[model samples]
Structures are given as C-alpha cells and as structure tokens.
Target: MDLITLTGLRVRGNHGVFDFERRDGQDFVIDVELGLDLRPAAHSDDVADTVHYGELATRLAEIVAGPPVDLIETLAQRLVDACLADSRVARARVTVHKPQAPIPLTFTDVSVTMTGTR
Candidate 1:
C-alpha cells in the first residue's frame, strides 16, 4: 500500500475529563497516515483517483472541534474511522496530541495513537 501522511494539524477542542478543561478548551494536535493504492492517481494525475487530503483535513478538524470526549483515545479512533471511510484507504493511523494536559508535573506533551484497517 502507498502512504499519504498529514501531520501537525492543530485545532482547538473542548475534550477532557475535567470541567475546567471542557469550559476553557485546549488545542489538540493531530497526525494522520493513510495507506492505499496510489498508482492510479500517480498514473492519471487526477485527484479523483485517490483520497483528497484537503477535504480529509477539514473533516478531521471538524471531528476534533466537534464534541467533547473525555479521552484522546476516542478522538483518535474517530479520526481513524473517518480515514477508513474512504473506499480507497486500506489502513489508517491517527495520533491525537494534548500538549496542555492537566498533569501536575511538567511534560512536553501527551498523546494517543490508534490504527485501524478495513
């Protein structure tokens, strides 16, 4: 399978277990990797032959900014599901990053990664 990757997609979302987190909201960084056959698109040079990443990014942003979920795992799964919705995609991997997580200790970031296949 060929690969198409989108990384460092940042969006603000109200997702967390804490009430303050939900009320204040925070930025979530997302990364998506889609595996599929790209030969058709490469040969034809037509976007229709493969997934449209721009639209996919918009859809992912909506998912991140849509509803409040307590776990980043759930968010990652949602993103994976969206990627797999495209018939051309054979596999998908998603990472959800929460840089400002409510950990008492200092940390660079917190993230959840999920992978799925059709």
Candidate 2:
C-alpha cells in the first residue's frame, strides 16, 4: 500500500489531568500516516485521486485543539476516526507528542500512537 505522511506538525492545545494542564496550553506534535492507492493519481496526476495532506491536517487540528480532553488516547482515537472518515484512506496511524511534559523529572518527551483501518 502507498503511504502519505504528515510529520512534525505542531499545535497548541489544552490537555491534561492537572488543573494547570487544563488552564495552560502546550505544544503537541502530530505525525500521521495514511494509506492510499496511488496508482490512479500517478496516472492521472490529479489531486482528486489522492489524499490531501493540508486538508487532513486542518481538520485534525480543529478537533484536537478544541474543548478539554483528559487523555491523549481519546484524542488519538478521535483523530483516527477523522482520518478513516475519508473514503480514500485504507489505513491510518496517528502519533501525538507532548514535548514539554509536566514531569517532576527531566525527560525528552511524552507521546501516544494509535492505529486504525477502514
């Protein structure tokens, strides 16, 4: 299967269990992989035959950055739903990274990855 990827997309969102986390926003990076059959697009050279990365990112950002969510898992699942909603996508995987985690100890990053198929 052919894959279309959107990597290192950063957005600010309010997500966490702590009160401060909810009040304060943080940078969240999302990496998405979408499966598609590129044969038609390759031959026709038409965007309509393939998935559009910009449009997908716009939709995902709107959902992820909206409202209050306690878990990244929920957000990931929601994103998966959005990804699969596109009939062109055969499979999708979403990863959300919380770089500035509120851990007492120093760490590189915290993240979650979820996979889905249509």
Candidate 3:
C-alpha cells in the first residue's frame, strides 16, 4: 500500500488529566499517515482519484482546536474514526503530540501514536 504522511501538525487545545491542564490550553502536534492503494491516482493523474490532504488538515484542525478533552488518546481515537470513514483511506497511523504539557521536569514533548484500518 502507498502511504501519504502529514507530519507535525500543530494546534492548541485543552487536553490532560489535571484540572489546570484542561483549564489552560496547550500546544498539540498531530502527524498522520494515510494508507491507500495509489494505483488509480497514480494512473489517472487526477486529484479526485485520491484524498484531499488539505481538506483532511482542515477537519483535523477543527477537531483539535474545537473542544476540551481529558485525554489526547480519546481525541486521537476520534480522528481514527474519521479516517476510516473516508473512502479514499484504507488505514491511517496518527500521532498526537503535546509540547507544552505542564510537567515539573524538563521535557521536549509528549506524544501518542495510533493506527486504524477500515
């Protein structure tokens, strides 16, 4: 299968286990690998033959910035569902990153990666 990857998509959201984490929003980065049979698109050379990555990006941004969630994992699962619903996508590997997590110790980022298949 051919895969199209969108990496390091950043957004701001309220997602965490702590009260403050939910109250004050933080930065989250999302990476997605969309799997599909590229034969049609490759042969036809038509945009309609494959998924519109720009539209996908917009939708993901909407979900990421729209609501508050207690866990990134839950939000990620929602994204997996959306990918499965898209006919062009056979499977997807998604990664959600939290760069501004309020941790006492110094850390670069926290992330969650998930895979789903239709």
Candidate 4:
C-alpha cells in the first residue's frame, strides 16, 4: 500500500500524570503514517481521491489541544481513531512525543506509539 506521512507535528497540550504537568501544559510532538492507495488521486489529479493532509493536520492538532489526558498512550490512541475516520486510510501509525516530561534526570524525549487498522 502507498503511504502518506506527516512528521514533526508540534502542539501544546495538557496531558500528563502530574498536577503541575497538566496545569502548566507542555509541547507534544505527533507523527502519523497513513497507509492507503494513492493511485486514484495520482490518476485523477483530484485531491478528493486522496486524504487532505492539511485538514488532517488540523484535526490532529485539535485532538492535542482539546482535552487533558494522563498518558501519551491515550493521546496516541485518539490520533489513531482520528486517522481511521477517513475511509481511505486502511492503517494508521501514531506517535505522541513528550519532550518536557517531568524527570529529575535529563532526557531528550519520551513517546508512545500505536498502530490501528480499519
């Protein structure tokens, strides 16, 4: 299957286990991989034949900014659901990255990845 990928999507969200984490909010980076057949769009030269990545990006960003969750895993699942909402997407892989997690030790980032199939 052909693939449509959106990487390094950053958003501010209040998702974490700690009180301060939710109160202060933090940056969340999201990456998505959508599996579908792009031949129809390629042949027809019409955007209707394929996913509108711009709209998808907006929706994913909404998910990030909408509600507060306790875990990146939950956010990842929500993203998978959103991706599958488009009928053309047969499979979706979503990753949610937490760069400003609360930890005493220094760390670059932490993330949760999940894949879903419709």
Q: Which of 1 and 2 is ahead in lDDT?
A: 1
State, as a TM-score between 0 and 1, how close model 1 is to the true structure. 0.98
lDDT of 2 at 92: 96
How many collisions per candidate?
0, 0, 0, 0
* TM-score of every candidate relative to the true structure: 0.98, 0.96, 0.93, 0.98
Candidate 2 residue pairs in backbone clash: none
Off by over 4 Å in 1: none
Tens-digit lDDT track of model 4 for 33-86: 999999999999999999999999999999999899998999999999999999
TM-score of 3: 0.93
Candidate number with the higher lDDT (3 or 4): 4
Task: Write one digit per residue (lDDT tens) for candidate 2, span 19-109.
Answer: 8888988888999999989899999998888888899999989987898698888888988999999898999999999888789898998
Better of 2 and 3 by TM-score: 2
Please give the range of 10 consecutive residues that has the lowest summed lDDT in model 3: 79-88
RMSD of model 3 against the true structure? 1.2
Full-model lDDT for every candidate? 0.96, 0.90, 0.86, 0.96
Taking every candidate in turn, the Cα RMSD to the unseen true structure, in Å, is 0.5, 0.8, 1.2, 0.6
In model 2, the worst 10-residue window by lDDT is 63-72
